[model samples]
Target: MKIVDLGDFTVDTQARRLYRQSEELAAEPKVIEVLCYFIQHADRFVSLQELHQQVWQGRVVTDTAVRRTISKLRTLLGDNDTEQPKYIRSQMKRGYQLVCPALPGEEPAVQSHAAVETNAAKKNKLIQSHWLKQLVAGSVVSALVLVVAFVLLASPVHLHTDYLQVELDIPGQKASLALSPDGHYQAFVGRVNSGDKWQLYLHNRQKGQLAKVSTPVPHVRFVDFVANGAAMAYVGFRQNVAELYIQPVADLAAKPQQYVLPGLSILAGPLALPNNQMLIAGGESYNGNIHYYQLDISTGQYSQFSF
Candidate 1:
């Protein structure tokens, strides 16, 4: 397939990086393979088997892997499911294709392609989905047990003893703060003027008062505190559009790394679980009923709350 330019983004086949304007968009290695395959085979709908073989090779892969990767790629490209996607488009039973325009950009070298068919891939996808549903159901049961244990065995008096209050102030803005799971840190959001000007700050409650946790940037909205207190989540914006970002506290001075939060904006109420994974409440707005999403720290994948 011929690579097309979309003005803002270019699929770099030779480099395996998706470029927006002049900057590279962060995408997983596997996601790049899947996207590059579609970009190379634009227009024609490529079946799941073909995509899996091309992207995953002879290795076994679950349908959740494909769906999750596509979902992540779409989010990375800021594509929405409601409209005809400007990046990837799904043809239901037929397969998936790249429909968005690719702009002028450098190409990556030697991207492996898959050669699987539609029907076989679809069946695998169904099986993967069925098993995933069962696993999620089991997780829900486990989660309920934990919640109940905390409620019954752990007395309210003991829970109240762990309570800590942290306050933060950002010069020239109204600040909002969220406490970490261990309650040792707080993530703050500051609004300078209105509409879009925002800043993210970290306050170390364990250090006595609220300490500045981050360097000042143009627009950063606090997303959550790392479950382990080693990092934080925030939303970074460019040209008015925003994307989710994760930054380790030790590397606060360096440019923050970006993570994909497909189709959603404004991740908040960051809670890091004991399992060392992160959780962020996501939606368009807080009052809009955000869905809680678990971040797989290892794969950077998102799993939605089942119950």
Candidate 2:
């Protein structure tokens, strides 16, 4: 039941685990023991000789070994100021003591509650702003074509039809673009120069703000807004293999879940369908025959479909 809340990190004494912002930190046994020892004896100073007898239990430990454990524990706690001593203070040959100045559980609880309130407020604002927008797309690539691939994709509304073309300030060549179903965001594939690697760029169309979407979307070749603007699915390559990814519109920065294609080698035609499903053209690797499939967005499963 003992937990050490160090403000920057928390320790589960029973599990011997150290965590920072919910991420489990890799620590040696000695590092955990040293951290736990410092926390349990925060009220008084701990001498080096005491640590050798108590924590190490006379295990033939050297001075360097003990110092290394202390150093590693400090790193895990993000304690950079050794002189001022934010978490643990080491006096020259005078041993060490925990100096974080918080009761074991008080600080982390306060921080977690504040974080929940801030996140709830932000989420409410986001949902309200997004609900006010809307995007119209009857075909899979119709809306996407109007954004990034406009110069190449053929529009059905007559070849010579004139429309106002407004260029965006984004650098380099843009490959693919998808407007959220509610027109709140734009997800596109772009690059810095001709040879630069392509990456997914998520733009808040309403706010005019831009950010780079992380991995799985890197080298992204195609993107489509799905689930009525709540999420998006895209085709990206990993290990030279074509993989599908699904990411939520609310959490675009989150790592997208990847889906592998079992039989189909060549994938094409991600036409939007009803019930959050999509139709894709799959071709056999050996034979040139193409097959049609229905992809379930919720499960990332693909099944054959007949015309």
Best by TM-score: 2
Query: For every model shown, what is its TM-score relative to the native structure?
Result: 0.41, 0.44
Off by over 4 Å in 2: 1-167
Model 2, residue 82: what's the lDDT? 70
Model 2 whole-model lDDT (C-alpha atoms): 0.69
* Residue 210, candidate 1: alpha-carbon lDDT: 42
Count of steric clashes across candidates, in order: 18, 1
- lDDT for each residue of candidate 1 in 1-307, tens digit (9 for 90 to 100): 2343554566657666666654455556988888788777776999888877877886898886688788877766667453667767887788887777545544533233332235346635654674586599789999988986787686865555444453444456745555665777777767556775676766666675543444434566555666466677666555544566677776667776666676465565555554457666676544566676766665565655422
Report the lDDT tens digits of candidate 2 across residue range 57-170. 988988876876786576556564678878888887678989986455522233365676686586456434443332233444566666545644656455554665543587
Clashing pairs in 2: 134-182
